[model samples]
Structures are given as structure tokens and as C-alpha cells.
Target: MERAEEGFGGGGILRQPPAVWATAGASVVAFMGIGLVDPILPSIARGLDATPSQVSLLFTSYFLITAVAMLVTGFVSSRIGGRRTLLAGLALVVVFAALAGTSDSVGQLVGFRAGWGLGNALFVSTSLAVIVGAAAGGSAAAILLYESALGLGMACGPLVGAVLGDASWRYPFFGTAALMAVGFLCIAVFLKDQPKPARKTSLLDPIRALSHGGLASAAAAAFFYNYAFFTVLAFTPFVLDMSPYRSGAVFFAWGVLLAVSSVLVAPRLQRRFGSLTVLGGSLVLLAADVVVLGYGSHTTAVVCTVLSGVFIGVNNTVFTELALGVSDAPRPVASAGYNFVRWFAAAAAPFFAPKIEEWSNVHMPFVVAGVAAALGALVVRVRRGSLVPAAVEPAPERVAPEGAEVLAG
Candidate 1:
């Protein structure tokens, strides 16, 4: 039997190695890239003399490349090792982010963002596997720590964007480049090259892993959920129509709730109701909140927008766990597969939301997001039996798969 001390309840979540801390700190910066442009979207549109939809392509191009690159991340990381892959990814981000700042046109900005996405895909897909390998206690603890970093990065990204972007839209891009350079140095110094897999993962491995029922179900659900998630992230700033500071402050509040709920609330809820149940319920709530956000007054929109963070936080945690453990595949391969399937929606949402608004009314996009969230809930409900493996408690002392270690030494 697993010892109680090895579990998340044992305070193992707080007792991580220097390697984990460094990686986590870097992860905070890497994830900051996701929302760093939030407060500056309008600024970019106006600065480049572009429309909102055109500026939205920044997200579309980034995530589109990110989704496709998911297939190659495991392939590359498995060959060169985790530490090298991480450094390479960080370097790419540093270059591309700096280049993005110099873009004189929306087309150039979108092109640069696509390069950033490729780097991000490599980093993000590998980071979870590294943390899970190096972390003490169990995979659960590692996952929680990862989620915490995500929340904190998300919370800070908009504020950074607002502060730097308030001076000029170009500043946020340069700032991201500088921060990622620091993250690159930290990773280079603190993280050793992880053990390579006995067998190199093929590009097709992630695609094949989707043959498993639980993994497929989880990926499908996440696909729908990501649409709503990104819609909130990408579209709501326009809805708010506030200054960079006010928008930053609002998203900061939302991100704070996201962090708090994912770290503090999600585990307790999962322990009681199980992961799928919690995920399903949270999706339903998100669906309702989004629809209301669409129809409500500005005050109502702001409140609902902040509240959506809680549901999003819960879903993020649960979905990540499911993607990692739902299949018999290696953790990195499984994650790659899962992300490959779901990130398409991340690409789609930003593109579609504005187009939908342009075609119909402003409210219609939120309604579409609500439907997507509801569809995510439906997938969870319909596929509940298949997700049983992920719903169970992950065993303590779960070791990294062959060749996927992120050991500090």
C-alpha cells in the first residue's frame, strides 16, 4: 500500500527539489506568453491599423502551429533529451518574441506569433513530464504544482501586458522575449539533461495513443472546453472595452481566482465527487456563465467573466490529470497526443469568435462558446465509463516512464 506521507495530503506539494522550482519558475514565464497579449489586443489592432478579427489571427496562427507541433514535440524531446529541448524552445521564444515586437504590420505580428507557438509547444509538452519526473510524493502533487504555475503566470501575464503595453504595444513582445531569456538561463543552469527513452517516439505515436477510449474521450472533451476557455481569454477584453489598466486589473482578478480555485478547491472537489463528475459539473456551470456573460450588461459581463475563472480552473486541473493518466501510454506521449487533439480548438476559438460576432451579433459568440462548453459537458457525461481509470487516485511513487526522466542530476 502507498504510504500516507507520499500522497498530496502529506504536504509533499510544497517540498520540491531545486530542479522542480527552477522548472516551475520557468513554466510560470512560459505560460505567461498565453495571456500576455490580452491587455494589448486593442493596442495592437490600432497600432497596426488592423481590425479586431485581423489581430485575433495572432492567437489563431500561434495556436494552429502549436497544435500541429504537438506531434513533433515528443519526437524531438525523446531524441535530444528534455533539458536540451527546453533550452531550444526557450531560445526560439526569445528570438521570435523579440522579432514580434519589431513587426510593422499585423501580418508580420501574426507570423512571428506562429514561431512563438512552435517554441511554446515544445516547452509546454515537455514541462509537465519533467515536473512529474522530478517532483517528490506523487504525480498528483506534481500536477498541482504545474497548475499553480499556470494560474500564477496567467494572472501576471495581463498585468505585465498592460503595464508594458500601456507604453507601447511593442513593449509586451520585447518584455516576453527578455523574460523567456531569463527562463532559458535558469533552465540551462538548474536542469540537467533527462534520460532519453529506450525507444525514440515516432511522430505517429501520439496519433496512435488516441486509439484508447479514455484518452480519446478526454481529448474530445478538452477540444470543446478549450473553445470556451480561449473565447473568454481572447474575446472578453473587447467586451470590457476598458483601459489597459482596468482590463489588466479585471483579468488579474480573474486569474487570481483561477489560481486559487485550481490549487485549493479542485483537489477537494475531485476527492469527493471524482474528476469526471467535477469536470462535467464545472462545464455546465461554465456554459451557463458564458451565455449570461453574452446577454448581461457591462457590469454583469465583468462579474460573470471573473466568475468563469473558477470553472475554468477546475476544468484545467481535471482535464490535465485525465490526459496524463487516462491511457497506458508514456506520460509525455500521452500528453502530446492529448494536446495535439485539443489545441485545435485553441486555434479555432480566437478566429471564430470574432468572425461569429461579425456575422451575427456580439452576443452570438458567447452563445457559441456556451454551446461548446455544454458540448464538453456532454462528452464527459457520455463517456464517463471510459474515464474511470483517470477518476481513480493515482498511485503514490509513480515513476517516470522509460527515457522521460527530468531528474536534476
Candidate 2:
């Protein structure tokens, strides 16, 4: 049998079935929703006459619902199957994105974004498993493909938002809706139903999966890491005080670096060192970078912001590998549980970063984010014993047929 790292049937990462490509394609559109509103944040604040904290609720609401909804993804997917679950998620995104475009107030927009988050939760949690199952290569290659889509979508989201949001804050929402509609059609046509688990998952299955010490450690560390990650994504646009086009350009660069490092750099680092070592070091570097971002001038801040993407990309791939491989649970269950813990940080950072600024100076938020990243590193250090090495495979053991087998023969 082929080694897991060598990939399935000796196929390369790029070679995959149509189902994998379709799932990955939709995943790109799904991830685009993450950064799609970034360039439009200031526009939304001004256009709706809202405070920065209120405007930041766009991220808060979306991720808050996503975090909570993760619990149900396995339950839903196991029963209805992957293809239907993906379609349901796409349908929700289409409806909510269009509704978000039509919102008259920050309140309405936040609510619509919350609805969008529910769809995002279902789609993202299921898409990873689908890609892994259908891809020609093994799990590592599938994850790289997913991360590449994340990078591309994140990169494109800002550019799209800048072009459309410059005219009006609402146009990006409508654009996302239309694009997801196309993604919906693609998945419908090209993706077949994924194989379901033998046992239907309960709503609490994800929660139970966290009982494994390694899974719990990975989730806890990722929770703090995501806090730092979203601080860059959801809060920095306001700190820069740039127009839609300029902000979009900067984040686009950041996203490009993120994509490249995730695909090209992370795997090499993993091979050279180990996943835990690489993750810990990357977290420390990210912490240092975020602190400098807090204290730096505009030029320094922009540079640090862009450079931080490299560390972020590495951390993302490593954490994902740990989450999926460290535990014995089903992939979907493990992913759901991992995301359920980490996405709360995605929600909390956006809401609290602006609030922190309101209560203190602007720099305090990044200071807090740096501390959070450091804590993530600390978690890795403390939990080192609990985490299983992701590359190690179990030894194969065979047993003879129970009833019909003869003695010694």
C-alpha cells in the first residue's frame, strides 16, 4: 500500500476527480465571503452612519453563527449527505447575501450576515471532508488544495469588494450572491453525493469528539490563534484609514502571500521540522509581528500586516493537519469540533477589537491580539505531550477468519 504522504495511487496533488474540483470550486466561493466585506467596512460605516464597533459586527455576527452552527454540520451531513448539505448551504448564502445587499441599517445587515454564517458553517465543514475523500492524492494534498482556494478567494474578495463597494457598500453583497449562485450550479452539475458514515451522527457528536486530548489541545490553541488572525482581517482596515481601493490592494497582497506560503512553504517546513515545532515557532513570530503592527507607523503597519500572512498561512495548514489527524474520530466530526472552538475567536476578535479601541487607545487591540498569539504558542508548548505526530501511521495487523479458519493453516 502507498504511504499516506506519498498520496493515493501515486497521483500528484493537482490530479483529482471532477467531484473534488467542484467541491473545491465551491469552497473558493465560500471562502470569498470571509474577506468580501473587508474593503467595504469603512464604506458601510459611513453609509449607515454607524460606529466602527457596530460596523465590525458584520464579522462578529457572521462568525458567531458559524461557530455555533458547526455542531450541526455533521448531524446534517451524515443524514442528508454531502451534496444536499452543500446545496442547502449555497441556497442559504444566495438568499442571505442578496438580503444583505438590500439592508437599510447596520442592524439589518448584521442579521443577514448572521444568516450567511449559518450557510458558511455547513458548507465549509462539509467541503473539507468531501475534498479529502474525492481528491486523487491523500489528505495532505487535499488540504493544500483547500488552503489554495482559501488564499485565492481571500485575495479576490477584497479586490471585488473594492471595485464594487467604491460605488456602493451594498454591491459586494449582491456580487457575492450572484457568484455563489454560479457555484451552486457547478456543484449541482459536477459533484455527486458523498458517501455517508455508517452511523448517523448526533448533534452532540462534535462536542464529544473533543474528548480526545490531542483534539482538545489543537482546538484550544487554534481558538487563540484565530483571535489574532481575525484581528488583522476584521479590524485593521479601520486602523489604516485607507479608501476601499488602497485597503483592498494591501489585503490582496497579504492574501497572495498567504496562498503561496500555505501551498509551497508549509509542507516543506513540516517535512524539515515537525508540525508542532513549526506551529509553535510560527505563532511566536506572528505574536511579534502583531505587536510591531500595534506600535508601528503606517508604513510599518502595512508591511507587518502583509508579512504576517506568511506565518498565518503556515499556522493554518499545520493546525488543520493536527485537527484532522490527531484524533480517531471521523474527519467531519473532528473538523466540526475543531471549528466549533476556533470560530468563536473569529467572532470575538471582530467585536472586541473595536470595543477595546473604544475603551483604550487604538494600539491596545493589537497588543491584546499579540498576547493572544503568544498564548497560542504557550498552549502548544504545554500540550506538546498530548499531540500525536501527524505523520505517523498505525502498523498493519491482520486476523484470520473467525469461524471457518483451520488451526495453523
**Against the true structure, whose lDDT is highest?**
1
Candidate 1 segments exceeding 4 Å error: 1-19, 131-145, 396-409
Model 1: lowest-lDDT 10 consecutive positions:
400-409
How accurate locally, in lDDT, is each candidate? 0.83, 0.82
Give the per-residue lDDT of model 2 (tens digit) for 133-221.
77775665665566567668877878889999989999999999998898899889888888888999888989999999998998999
* Steric clash pairs (candidate 1): 196-403, 197-403
lDDT of 1 by residue, 260-299 (tens): 7765677679878988889999999999999999999999
TM-score of 1: 0.91
> Against the true structure, candidate 1 has what lDDT?
0.83
Candidate 1: C-alpha RMSD after superposition: 4.0
How far is 25's C-alpha from truth in model 1 (Å)? 2.1
Each model's TM-score, in the order given? Answer: 0.91, 0.89
Tally clashes: model 1: 2
RMSD of each: 4.0, 7.6
